[model samples]
Every structure is written in C-alpha cells, then in structure tokens.
Target: MELSEMQALARRVRSKYAAMETARYGREWTDEEIMLGFLGDVGDLAKLVQGKAGVRPRDDLDEALAHELADCLWCVFTLADSYGVDLEAAFTSTMAELDGILAAEDTTT
Candidate 1:
C-alpha cells in the first residue's frame, strides 16, 4: 500500500481503539496513553532485537525483526497522525540530512 493508504489505515485502527476504550473505560485514551503505547512498541522492538541476538527466546529472527519494525512504524505513524504531522515531509528531510552527513564524512576520509 502507499503511504497515504497506510496513514488512513492507521487512523482507522486508532478509531477502533478509541471505540473500544469508550466502551470499556467510559472514555477514550488521553494523549499520554497514546505516547506510552508508542514507547511500549519501541520497547517491544528492543526486546525482539535482543531475542535475535540470543539474549532471549529464540525464534525466526528475520521474520520477527521485520514484524517488530513494522510495529514501530505503525506507532510512529499513529503518533504523527495524532499531532497532525506530515510523515512524508519528515522522512524526506531526515533522509536528506543523513545523506549530507554521509557525503561530508566520505569527503573528509
């Protein structure tokens, strides 16, 4: 799917979570809850990496890592949506900065 499609899907998932929260907890989650959820996903990715490094439960390392990375992206996209941020712009700018840094390092060495 395209990035726009992925963003829309993330929003739909967020709405589903909101509906569940309202039904179960009598209200939707606060922004803090969303932030914590994102952090939790990051922690999960770290654990998955550790597991692949043989520090925890062994599994299909490559597949597990891909899923963990996708989870991380979902959390990032969700958080960006919450804040009305442009993910494509952010990614583009960051990649440009990284490219410049790498080019400078190459020239220096």
Candidate 2:
C-alpha cells in the first residue's frame, strides 16, 4: 500500500490499541507506554527477521517476518502521529543523513 494508506491504517491500529489499554489498565496509557509499545514491536520485528534469516528457525518464516515488519511500521506511524511529526519527511531526512555519513566515511578512507 501507499504511504498515505499506511498512515491511515496506523491511526486505526493505534486507536484500537489505546481503547484496549484503557479497558485493561483502567486508564489511558502514558506517552512512555506508547513508546515502550513501539520498542516492543521493533524487538518482535528483529526476532522475526533473525528467524527468517536462519538465525533460529528452519520453518518458512516469510509470513511471520512480513507481519512483524508491518506491525513495527504501524507502531512507528502511531508514535509519529501522536507527536504530530511528519513521517515522510522524517524518513527522507534520516536516510539522507545516513547517506551523507556513509559518503564522508568513504572519502576519509
């Protein structure tokens, strides 16, 4: 799906999770909780990738990896939205910074 579609889906997922948290915890989660949730998703993604890359499992891992990655992205999108950040611009800027860092290292070598 396109980035816009992904953003929309993230909002929906975040809302649903927020509702669940409120119901289970008896209050809305703090920003820290949301951040932790995002990190948790990232950890899950890492595990899925490692397994798919044969670090842990021998079974077909493609579906699990894809799902985990999508979940990770959803959490990232939610965090960005919560803070009123523009993900597209942030992604582009971060990638450019990484590229520049790599280029500078190449020149230094």
**Maximum-TM-score candidate:** 1
**Per-residue lDDT of model 2, residues 16-103, tens digit only:** 8779988999887777887887788888778877886778774657877787787777777877888999999999999999999899
Give the per-residue lDDT digits (tens) of candidate 1, residues 63-89: 877987987788788889888899999
The stretch of ten residues in a row with the least summed lDDT in candidate 2 is 52-61
lDDT scores in order: 0.87, 0.82
| Cand. 1 Cα-lDDT | 0.87
Candidate 2: which pairs clash? Answer: none
TM-score, every prediction? 0.86, 0.78
